[model samples]
Target: MVDANVMKKTFTVPEIKPLDQYDFNRAKVCASVRWLLAKSYGSAENVPADLREPVLIGQELQAGVSVLLLSPDLYWRAHSQLHLRGVSQGPGQGPGGVSKGPGQGPGGVSQGVVQGGDHVALLQLLASRGHAPRDQDRPVTVEDLQHTPIKTRAHLALIDALMSLAAMETVGRVKMAAEAEQIGGGSPWENALLFWVNRLNQRLRESTEDDDDKTQTCTDLQPAQPAIRYRKDKVQSKLTPTFPLVSGVKDLSNGCAIAAVLHYYCPSRLPLEDVCLKDTMSVADSLYNLQLIRTFCCGTLQGCCPLAVEDLLYAPPTLHMPLGC
Candidate 1:
């Protein structure tokens, strides 16, 4: 059972500051993206010595790989309200529904609506910045992405890694949801729920495989088979269940990271997949606490500042110290 104390704690929005205040934060993110791109597509001299050989060799073998980047506008609009201050209810919760409280069930992995959208925006902005010398001034488009080939093997490897991450997240969410329901019903070990959840996941995987098979068959029969058309609205409505909007920031981060990494390495392939959720409460909590520390430090010193990247990547030391020390 979820602790009542945990459920009672409110999740406040991070304070809004002027865009200039976040310059360091934004620059750090952009720099990481630039580094990843350089490693993936740059010439041997441009790439770090350690990565030069692999990147150059990979370029020759991974020529025709493609990725599709889907627009996140629908997702952004879906969870726009979650960013507002003092809004306690989680995204998509109806009246009197179970609110996703701090430390309640798998809240640690819950997606932050604002952060996810921010990542999407960052990717789009970076993609607009062109890759090659001749194409650097030209604007990137969906058409450009569809036809472009991935230049580096590392970039393709990263995409595969992200797919694995996304699959893990999908499985985690399904298991978490099932566990929450089981706990809510006063039986933590319900065999039926466990079996049902497993069955559902298996079906989803089978459906994806079936779709791939059908697509391959359709490609072979394209010349003789007439195109089937449906109203846009009807198609979208049918797809709504399969493509949920409440995706976690980690997944969004993965997409943005992939896009930024591939923009220069493989402009032709945009990463695309069905949208899914991620639990990000733990990361959010860490950020919130870090900001609080920064606030205190700034108050003590006139302008206490540190590299945002260090703060982001820092991990708390796990030490076994004596109490007296």
Candidate 2:
């Protein structure tokens, strides 16, 4: 069933008239290339070396915001904290590793690379525990996850994924707490909301750190009541207006990708934005399998536009509408 809120947005008629820009030639170019690359290989890292400039140009045209297309697997790692939950290796199983089911070889152990099956098993296990399985077609259980054996590299990758997720959450909460009242009901969309909050808060902090008065104001704004008063007493409460958690997903998704934007801030800096998961398709697609419920954030459109709910997976690469529109 479609989310009712998501449904309503599809019919929304925008109130504000469109305004002209200085020529988003740069932004358009970047967005187009980013979209093409993401769609072609289901990852931006696969973007050809030659077209990178045009893509950056497109991003400039679209405003400073660049529509980043990520490999579904990398998308999960960055935006969804699903990888944090370690792969279950069965009941009473030790950390060293032992095969619990089929495919066991000599010494009743599994060896070699950790395949996508192992990841899916972990997802299934989590879903059963949470009772939030996305797929009705493939029924799986925690028992299955407990039996999958993953290689050391996959294990380490999972750990790194978890750390990244935690960092995003820790930072996001810091930002959210500052404007808790402004955030409406419901848990922040379980995927990317927290990540955005973290990035915006980081930017706000970095921007104001050098200014003593600004620093004091930000610190003073920490407590809710004091923050309210500070808002009245201080002239600039809107510097980075607390991002209102609306009944949509664009803000959260954009926030998660801010790190990517930061990568492009200066030419001298290395671009880590194009980094891809070692195994992109198989690993990422497995998340959608009944065993794993990991949600990837890409092409997630959200904003004041009419088709805000039209997610990246569903729409075309380039559009005249706003990035999240």
Candidate 3:
């Protein structure tokens, strides 16, 4: 077991600079971090550096969003509150007191208002949970923003701005792709995707080889149950481990790049315009592991893993399309 003190010692908190000091782009990212820290730590100022550093890296806004998405505690809390507020508000008081039905916002204007409302609601919720500054009556400044509701609101707005920018960038790329020659096979997006995919596959292969070596070394210590041993050996031999369809892209930019590539080369593959490739990858990875576990468990019980009815309706598909094509 690891020592708690050693673990604590290993953790370092990154410096949370004044929000004003960060240009608009960075401040937006920091805002998401602040919101997360505020949820977990009660005060954004109290957020540990170790947790803050990763979100601060490339595509901070997306990183921050990913953090929230992965953490049920944070995601549900914010989402629940947002949902409650949306339902409680009167018809005329639609996000920011601007009257608009669901999906009827004035393009960009209502988006900004809705985001502003979300930030305020989040900060208010945090404040109720004792995360807000005690000196609520005091004049708000950049430093004060860290522990104040205003800071939370600003951070929320920043998050919205960052998302809008990302959407615009994606649209611009799609438009460019339509007008330009097929991004030659050597485009940067394709190269990056290829690099990450190859790296993942290579690592997987290495890990499998290591596992096989370990299994051989541990053969002498095998359990006395012949049935168990046979099942384990059979499962190991029969399992054809292939990379899951959506396992390669790790970050938002890479996910978007992959999506763009898909849209450019095989448009039918994308079912949604605003498809979150990262989320899809996450789901695919989960399903792949679950299927493997189910197969192993059922095999041990002398039963077969049952495929879903939908899966049986179609022919078994390849893990993914060839990268070279």
Candidate 4:
């Protein structure tokens, strides 16, 4: 960073703000993108030395990011320090220290295996950056780059890490960073309810009409929901609507809504198999689902602001904005 010099015709360009869309012309064609990364991470010194270099928009960023992801620590650190914004302390040196130096993959193994904690951190960071792998069930092992068992996990994670970086580069910052207030008097719950209802109506084969504040299965409805059009023997079959009707705010007490919404937004974080469309029968059931939602939001969905089970269950007016957004 240097002072603007009228003598040299060089002008001061502000650092690309987080969540704000990057100005391609100034960011790439003119200004060094290294300044943006440095500023984002706090200072040039705070930025990890490994990734401290000028980068253009395309191949340069991709190549640099891929090389960084091979070790896990650098790429995770870059996003954590540069993007997570107090969400996490980046990837920690888990059970084993991360791999360092070139040609240090499988051969230099002793301290390179990514442990369970690191694996979770990587996934959370990646998923939060909207770069989670499509294949969610598969686990990242202690031997990601350390050992090659049929397939290399490094390449798989590389794609995620690279795309995650790209997303961080392009994602738009939230509107009105200076001051945030609910636009209308208060309509977050109603707006969220309408948005979900309308969106699900379009995508889902059919949705339960959640007209009342009652916990009831699809069968319990006064009139059965519509069946899907597809058929096995030219005869239409009734598709059981996994997502039940959400009448009022309390209807989301079960972790079902969180799973469904987050799954829809970021499917890699919460797979379709994990979403339970059923309503909670008891407090234990609600808590179990709520815990899952909390982990998903706080860990997997790293970008989203953390919300507690009480906040979610109680359906407070304060949460209307978060829910709607």
List clash counts for every candidate, in order: 12, 20, 2, 3
Task: Kindly provide the TM-score of model 2 when superposed on the true structure, using C-alpha atoms.
Answer: 0.28
Q: Candidate 4 clashing pairs?
A: 19-172, 19-173, 20-173
TM-score winner, 1 or 3: 3
Q: lDDT per prediction?
A: 0.28, 0.30, 0.33, 0.41
Tens-place lDDT per residue, model 3, 92-170, is: 4432232454654421123222222333443454444333323334422334334422344444443332222222333
Alpha-carbon runs more than 4 Å astray in model 2 = 1-123, 129-131, 135-182, 186-199, 202-206, 209-248, 252-325
C-alpha lDDT of residue 281 in model 4: 38
Give per-residue CA lDDT, model 2, range 1-325, as digits (tens).
Answer: 1111222333222222122432333333334334433432324444345543432332332211122221122222222222233434464332212233456432123342121334453344334444322223444333322323312222222322333333334434444554543445433332334344445545534443434344354465463221112222223222322222323333323222333333334312322222111112232221121111011132222111112222221223222322321
Which runs in model 3 stand beyond 4 Å of their true positions? 1-153, 157-198, 206-237, 245-325
Give me the candidate number with maximum lDDT. 4
| TM-score of predicted structure 3 | 0.21
Question: Could you tell me how far off, in angstroms, the CA of residue 76 lies in candidate 2 after the best superposition?
Answer: 13
TM-score of each: 0.17, 0.28, 0.21, 0.31
On residues 1-325, what C-alpha lDDT tens digit does candidate 1 reach at each position? 0111232244232443343443432333223222232322321134334432221232232112122122222223222311222323456332112234444321111442122333234234233322111133443333343333532222322222222222233334444445434323222222223333335434444554565445455355543321222233222112211211212122212122212222223323321121111222343433343343334334532212222322232321100000000
Q: How would you encode candidate 4's per-residue C-alpha lDDT over 85-169 as one tens digit per residue?
A: 3243223321123333443332122243222335555566556655554424554443554342322334344333443343333
- On the 0 to 100 scale, the lDDT of residue 130 in model 4 is 56
Best TM-score among the predictions, by candidate number: 4
